[model samples]
Target: MAARVDVKLAELGISLPRPMQPIANYVPYVVTGNLVVVSGQVPAIDGKIAVTGKVSWSVSVDQGKEAARLCFINVLVHLKAACGGDLDRVRRVVRLGGFIASPSEFTQQALVMNGASDLAVAVFGEAGRHARTTIGVPSLPADAAVEVEGMFEIE
Candidate 1:
């Protein structure tokens, strides 16, 4: 039930931040059948990017990881909205896609994405374990250090 999940989130000291509106034309998430496909989210909090710039250049690997975490938190904000405010509707975290803004030589993308991956497990237990892809890119919207998107199975 969402109550349990809400309590868990509270216990974890995570209060879902306000959902960010699409900076472009796309909607935040689309529900088709049982799946909610979320749009990519950058590490924004309080309507501003929490971290920016290329990883391992101006940003450290740890900072990249934290940015990934912040992005996931933003993902949850929309995911909850897509679920009609009942997070319990989510049955599983099917997959996560992460894009790390980093130099061409950076190779620690997967490790940095662990920030989102780990939090998913913490929130959904076994259901949070998911297939994932992590990639390096030259830049992202707002020049955030990381961006994360997700696919969720819902009921």
Candidate 2:
């Protein structure tokens, strides 16, 4: 039987891709005590970067939001692996950090991060409401429009 979260994802038409492998010398997630800290995730779908470049410059706000959404989906993928393939083990979404690659003049980082935040709530409901920090950066790995990292409390 599929986990309830899996069913929810399906209902939302979200098809999680295979968890991305680390491009550098680091693991995708780290488990410490009862928490899993996921490394920053970019908008990679089907083993390719789906969105790249600076937000509001090379990428539009809507595209950046979609990239953020994909980043969260990737975070969930790492979280599922951390929980041994069971997302139900998650107790709470502790925090999420978002990095938006934008031009120096761009200032809608928070709005762009809403893409991931909204999905978090949709998937985890109240538990998904979490502390978050969003920042605009000049660039990110692969020039991804957005990158998201998360901390999840697990049983």
TM-score of each: 0.97, 0.97
Tens digit of per-residue lDDT, candidate 2, span 1-155: 88888888999999878988888999999999999999999999987889999999889999999999999999999999999999989989999999999888898999999999999999988999999999999899877789999999999
How many backbone clashes can be found in candidate 2? 0
Q: Give the clashing pairs for model 2.
A: none
Per-residue lDDT of model 1, residues 4-40, tens digit only? 6788789889999988788999999999999999999
Q: In model 2, which runs have C-alpha deviations exceeding 4 angstroms?
A: none
- How well does candidate 1 score on lDDT at residue 92? 98
Clash number for each model: 0, 0
CA lDDT, candidate 2, residue 108: 92
After superposing candidate 1 on the true structure, give the runs of residues whose Cα lies further than 4 Å from its correct spot. Answer: none
